[model samples]
Target chain A: MNKGVAVTGIGVISAIGNNTGENYRSLISGKHGISSPEILETIHKNLPVGEIKISNESLAEDLKLPKNHSFTRAALLGAFAVKEAVTQSSLKIDNETGFISGTSVGGMDTTETYFKDFTQGKTENSRYVRAQHPGFTTEKIAEHFGITGFVSTISTACSSGANAIMLGARMIKAGKLKRVIVGGTDCLTKFTLNGFNSLMILSDEQCKPFDENRNGLNLGEGAAYLVLEAEEELKGKPVLGIISGYGNANDAFHQTASSENGEGAFLAMQKALKIAGISSESIDYINTHGTATRNNDSAETEALKRIFSKNLPDVSSTKSFTGHTLAAAGALEAVYSLLSLQNEQVFPNLNFSYPMKTSGFMPVTKLKEKPINYVLSNSFGFGGNCTSLIFSKNGG
Target chain B: MEVKIYINGIGSISAQSGDLFSGDSARIYQENIFQAISPNYREFIKPMALRRMSKATKMGITSAKIALKEAETEVPDAIITGTGEGCKKDTEKFLENLLDQNEKLLTPTSFIQSTHNTIGGQIALNLSCKNYNVTYTQNSVSLETALLDAQMQFDEDPEIYSILVGGVDEISEKITSFRKLDGQLKSKSIKNLDLLKEDSTGTITSEGAHFFALSKEKKQNTYAEFQTLFIKNTIQPENINEEIEAFLKQNNLDSEVIDVVILGNNGDNRYDHYYKNLQQNLLKNTMQLTYKHLVGDFDTASGYAIYLAANILKSGKIPSVLKLNDIDSKTPKNILIYNQYLGRDHSLILLSAV
Candidate 1:
């Protein structure tokens, strides 16, 4: 097998915590971050969300940006996550580094706020007009990091972050660059709040992932990043984990809903296992893409059954802790997966009391300490994009 | 060992035609701001699923079906898509409803579809081909990014036989109007046929979906062999020549070997210099071609360029409408497509006649 991509460093700012250590503490303690909307100014205040407690102004101030900075909430979160990743990776911001970011709504937070103002001759908010496109958000992040080479963005819904990681690995394997930082960021907005509300998938209660009474998902906002480096370039660094394998597949079944059999999820898991040169039994834990929606939990359970047969590994949906962070979900879960491997722990799938009737699979509802080696993470999104990423301890 | 990836099958839904093979024979739209002739999406997608799909998803699914049919492949090893604006219809719908309703009682469907990867995800959901699916949205290079991913899959494993790849974009009323306000779209409507000659400051906005079934093994229906694809985030007009030279040298080919050079010129006076710089210098002697006049300009418009290149390579015949220069070749053998948007997301794609 090709030498796996080295994940030298990671950074995260999610609802559960900020940065790697904080998030790990929350995950291990089974502290669910779901709370009634505090930061997001929305009419549906009853709906729970995994919102970062920081305000945009506070974030901007923390980044030490100029007062007249046009950075959107998405960019702000992205900058924070990326800054942490860069510092953790200890890589100099030079011409050689590449930045690939995944974002669903690049600057919708600012655009939504400024859309009508532009018609009223508000030139100050007009700067956000160009930021609506996803590339502009990534460009802003690249600019902040002083990166000028191979900068790009991927916008594959929830799987965008995973796909970004996959692309970074491919670029490194192709000998394109020595180091690259890849991940995704998204700031919850009234646009997404109402968008998901219209679909009637936003649960009023804390999201009960894999629970029989699970109503729907709680939308969250945050950013997470992983710094992936070539093996030779990672000399003497603390390798957090290794991105052993990654697979992406399309459900091709519907626009938003996954298939009954979870074909895409199954295929992604299978492909990832193949790439990692491991069997289903070797996977010690699974970070499911269980949004607690009736469709997602059932479909994902079925997929797990198909991949693992009778002896499935301990599985949990961290969405209970962080909600569904959309594009950041993949990277967030990637960070959690690495933490699980590092700590040899199995995080609880909060609010899950009963298994879904279809797959009859139950999640690990209590934190358990064990010898964890390999962890599989799944993130599926609209347009039936399914991605599975396998992370393993070094030399596992 | 390296594997040669071939364009086994192709499909598209644009201003030209929804059918891949039939696009060349399709009627030429002379209007500048042409919209895609949407197919009967209900025939392909179920109502429950179709209710929430935006124009981008519908176009993406329909074109993906056509591509799969053309290749006669039931399932591909991977499904990857590139989109620039991604699910604009839903994005607009959600935004409009939010602004109009004051962010009350909105649904999740529009927001879910608004994600750029939704088209790729929806296609995967429809096909149940859960292999390797990704969506790239790097401005104009969105489609090229997907193509590059497909190429990497082929290079990584020869066992990866077939990959479904495409680029899609859609225009919504509000977004299109705002784009016009920002001078991204041409102010005046001009005939599509006269797009090149028009002295316009911006491009006529349009949308399209182009899907291709790429495989390592060339089949009877293979359109062309995708040789190499390159992308650069930024390029200056002065550096265009050097970039092209270096790109060709890295690919172990030269300008003389390229039979056709498809340029992305959308009648924008400001950025048209990027194309003019190429036409006047490095590729002056090459048989130049252009297509945005017919399809208008969008992020993934380069997909249509790929469609055009594939057709020329397959038929060995150049349509009279696409000719930008009189430099003729006996038969189109090698093709190079270069595209960008607002002078960013620069991409170069090379296709060879198989």
Candidate 2:
């Protein structure tokens, strides 16, 4: 097998915790961040969500942003997470260092607040007008880090973060960049919350992944990032994990739902395994997309069975702790996968009491220690976007 | 060995009709913000689906179908799209309703289609091509990023023989109008043809979609060979020429070998200097051309520039409306496309006659 792309550092901020350490501690402690919304001003207060308690003003203050700074909530959280990753990697930003961020709503929060103002010819929030585009949010974070080369943004719904990481690995393999920061960031917004509620997919209780009685998902807000470097650029740097394989495929099935067979998820997993030059048996654990929505859980389970058959590895959905963070789900789970590799432990899938009826598959409901080498993380989203990433303990 | 990429087919829906570059007279708009000339989307989309699709989605799907049909490919190996402010109409509808209705009794139709990847995903669903799909939304460099990804796909997967790539953006009612408050559009009304003449603060803004069918294999109808692409998030105006020179030199070429330079000049006095620096200095001898004046300016307007470059290289004809200088090229062999938005997301795409 070929040596994989090296992951030097990782950072995350979610409902469970604010940083990597806090998130990890919460993950192993079975702490769920789901609750009624407090920070987001929405009428659906009874609906449980994974809302980060920090306010936007407080976030901007922590980042030392100026009064006139036009950072959206996503940008603010993205910068918060990116700062930690950059610090941990001790990376020196340069012209060859690229930044690829995945975000779905982007600055919709800002847009929602300022739309009426702009229509009334108010220019106070005019700076945020451009933030409506996902790339504008990316540019704000890139500027914060002084990364001038090859900055871009991906917006593939919930799969955005996974796609960003995949593109970074592919770019490194293609000799396009010496180093890159890849991940996703998304904050709760009335737009997304109401949208999911309109679909009747937002659960009023904590989501139970892979459970027969699971109702739906609890929306979450957070950001996570990984610092990926070319092998030659590492220069004795400590490697946290290696992104050995990645794949993306379209279901061409439906807009917001997966097929009964999870064909897209299957193709993505197969392709990722092929890229890793490994077989299904080599995977030690699976971090499923497991959004807890009836269709998603069953479809993902079917896809998993198609790949591993009776020899399924230890699988769990960390979303039980962080809620469904949309664009940030993939990168957030990726960080959990790296943590699993580093600790040789599988984080439990919380709130799951009964096994899914159709597949009758059981997930590790409690933290389990294992001799894990390869961790595969799945992220599926709207527009039939499905992606799978394999992180190896040792560079393969 | 590296595989060669060819631009075999192109489809576009913009403010000007398809005949704009085909020797037909161009339509001049006097408004600051204009809309694209839409096709009979019924010809491409079914009534049920069309009812749900926003203008951006309809334009994206139709243009993609036109491109795929022209390339004579039933299904592409991959579908990649780049959109700026994707499905804004839908996004606005959802947000407006959420605000007005206080998040009560909302529908998911508009919200489901607001995603930036909606276009790419719809194209995949239409063709039932469960192949690689993705979307980029990095503004002016958005389309260039897609092109770069397409180039890499050919190298990453041997089975990916053909990929459909495009850039799309559409005007929204309140969102597009917000540009006026932020100075993204001119404060005064002006004719589209006279956009370049006025020493203005902002250029006229419009929306369009341009799709290209890129394949690894050369065909009899190949328009041009995709040569090289370079993107930088930021660069000082003074350093732009050096960046361009270095980029061209890395590809074993320089200013002399370039026969035509398609510049993205949107008549913004503040940022047009980035283009003017090259027009006056390094590329003075080259036959310079521009297209934003005709199509208006948007994040993906460069798609029209690429369309122009590929057509000119294939037909060996230069449309007079795009000419920016008196210099002429007997047979344009190499064409360069340079674009940026508000002095950021700078990109360079080089195309050569095969």
TM-scores of all predicted structures: 0.91, 0.99
Candidate of highest DockQ: 2
Over 4 Å off, model 1: A92-96, A118-124, A351-362, A365-367, B17-32, B39-54, B105-113, B125-128, B197-200
* Two-chain DockQ for each candidate model: 0.53, 0.92
**In each prediction, how many residue pairs overlap at the backbone (N, C-alpha, C within less than 3 A)?**
31, 0
Task: Give me the overall lDDT of model 1.
Answer: 0.84
Tell how far residue B304 is off in model 1, in angstroms: 1.5
In model 2, the runs with Cα more than 4 Å from the true position are none
lDDT (10s digit) by residue, model 1, range B298-350: 99999899998998899887887788999997788999999887887788999
Best candidate, TM-score-wise? 2
- lDDT by residue (A22-119, candidate 1, tens digit) is 88889888887888888787788888888999998999999998988889888999999988888988986654577888888888888788778765
Instruction: Give the CAPRI class of candidate 2.
Output: high
The best candidate by lDDT is: 2
